[model samples]
Target: MLKHPKNAVMVLARCFSDLDRRLLLLILIPPLSLIVFFSLSSLSPVRSFILGRTILHPQQAVMLNSTDSQQSDVVFAPSSWKDELDRSRIAVCLVGGARRFELTGPSIVEKILLEYPNSDLFLNSPMDSNAFKFSLLNSAPRLAAVRIFRPKPMPESELQLRVLTAHNSPNGIQGLLQYFNLVEGCLTLIQQYQKQNNFTYDWIVRTRVDGYWNAPLDPKFFVPGKYLVPPGTNYGGLNDRLGIGDLNTSTVALSRLSLLPQLDAAGFHQLNSEASFKAQLTTRKVTPVLKRLPFCIVTDRKYDFPPVRFGVPVAAISSPGPLSGVKCRPCKPVCQGPCVGDVMEGLNKGWGWTDWANGTLELCNAHGDFDEGWEKMFDKVAGKKLSSERKRVWKLTVEKCIANFNKMRNRTGIWDTPPVDEICKTGITSGPK
Candidate 1:
């Protein structure tokens, strides 16, 4: 109880010394040292550290702090082009007959339409027995316009005869004219919709109904200035199977028929579909950018099996690919690896050659028709829901088909085609008139 003042002072001094030693130990530890160092640094230096700069030695910290404080302020960068496109108006212009639409349509719905649910769909197809398949679009998210018309023979002008060739086109020059009309016709419909609504679409995706998409359309394909098309199957020109571009470039690319006079004037002769497409872009001064895309044109056309040089190599539907809109069908792959390399070597580089390197392509012996139970094969590859759609279409009754068509017609902003009864009945049993 009778403690001396000197003894109390000595106890206090010893306590202060112990606290200092503990504080030094804490600062010397790696984790706490970092925190202490940052705490002591100026705000600008701390901000630089957080913005991916390495912390300097304590000796250099003061120098960095002084330099960073003198520099301009940092600013955040904007979002990517994909984010811009997600908000922008996009028109998915699907052209061609619904020949294999049952196999292909669901993929379009799942990959493109659902992937970009805000994009409007414009369906321009010539009515055929397979036209009933177009009814599947009732499941699509944004159906904008539908034009299923009777195939009328387009009058082949002298210029068309000169500028276009019947070489590989099954229907000859007339067929080319009809296809051109269909594509350009979709552009016209898009323009009409824009005029009516007082707003223009920022992008247009021109693709075929027969395309079996194995993957979603990558947003990187949506480049602003240049038109994007597939790299191979140039056929002495560019791959015309699919195209993606802005409004201005698409107008030039899609005006397939209207630009015939321009092609004729440019002295382009005997040009096939792809060549004509290339001519159009060249004439219009639109630079085309080629990227390998994930879909292929599902075809019934027979090509030489074990394709020779310059012969078409049909891809197996199951091949892992950005197949770039090449001809494909479901079948057991006949060729792979070295076999693919040898077959691809024979094919003309400017014509049918696709990048088969690193096992990117698998070949189908397409000389025969699609293998039996191809639906099962497709289902296995496309997943449960898409396969179910295929079965539904195959087993579709006339009544249900008509009902689906009605729903699609109701959703469509522009409906131009035969009556629903006729479209539905044509594909199903041909009953008494």
Candidate 2:
């Protein structure tokens, strides 16, 4: 059993080589697995978790403006403005608070990219410094939305009264108060961006986070010298439903709170979206162009139209609907001997609603809960590239958004980046654009 000293050295060398190989494999697998995981997540198709395909067009090309029937799906317009909004022109703006955006965000994106393929999409939401806020919306005409300012939650007494009576809603003035703040923000956007950039919009289309659309907005709706809004579902007056106004008109209309005193001094009372719609026109001398749109309010409130004291549900014909300013889907054409005749009749005549009552309703069933099977349904209607972008962001869970958020918060310059100023030309920097 004599063994040479050199034999022991060889055995030791073999063991060392095996140990090195093991170490290499250990280091390599985790990152490789992570890479695969991230890649797979990116590849998974994006489905609107809340607003499904109900409001989107299955084929994206269908959304391109009729005139520019061959535009690209992704439009990065080099940050410019088109002042005179023509019938052929498209303008898109996102109006939301950047909270719970994941629920109905896709519907807004799909609708804009679809309806106004030739349009430039603008984002004007306020978000927290958290990375999750604007991730769903950074895909299109992205401007750093305003920082959302939510007042401290009021006491239960005030909350109950505010919630119960339309007159007592926060910031009073009923009918989409936050909408006015958002409008004011957008108007600020228009004023600052336009002044610095010397650019204007033909039409400013304002929409919300929870509005799930079932169909595309047809171009025939745009008539000159008129603001277009969805009719019916106007609690007392205009729907605030979705608004599209030219620069001259929108400048004042979107100035919600600021304009209220002007409206009030002009004898505006019992104003809701509907009454305000009339007052904005009758008082301010701006007439609205009523159009039946394909969208439904994705709200958290319950309405008791008739026979049900205060908390009866007004259900949609379809579950996940765009409900595009049309007659609501009746569970049965003639249900229960017209118990909710007022709700049904107001819908039928088309008060201030911009829904699609002519045919089927684009239903959205996110009632304090998201719709089921929405993923598949959304996939059916979403644009390929947009879906891909959403997938990319979600999969990566891009945490850098916090950086973007903070960076925007620290920003003081408002006009530098808008279409008006050339960084090279201006030399003096104003942080916000």
**Candidate closest to the true structure, highest TM-score:** 1
The sequence of per-residue lDDT tens digits that candidate 2 reaches over residues 1-433 is 3299898888899999999999999999999999876655344234232323222232222223222223434321211212122234344555665443443566566656644555655556543332143445444443423434432333333322332235524454333555556666666765665566566666677776556565655544444466776655565566665777767666656766566566656756555545655566666777665555766554444333431322223345343434544323223222222333443444434333333334333232223333455444444554464345445444432345444434544432231222111211121132111
The parts of candidate 1 lying over 4 Å away from their true place are: 1-80, 430-433
After superposition, the stretches of candidate 2 with alpha carbons farther than 4 Å from their true spots are: 1-91, 114-118, 128-133, 141-178, 300-322, 325-359, 362-368, 371-433
lDDT of 2: 0.48
TM-score of each: 0.81, 0.56
Q: How many residue pairs clash (N, CA or C atoms closer than 3 angstroms) in each of the candidate models, in the order given?
A: 1, 47
lDDT, residue 60, candidate 2: 24
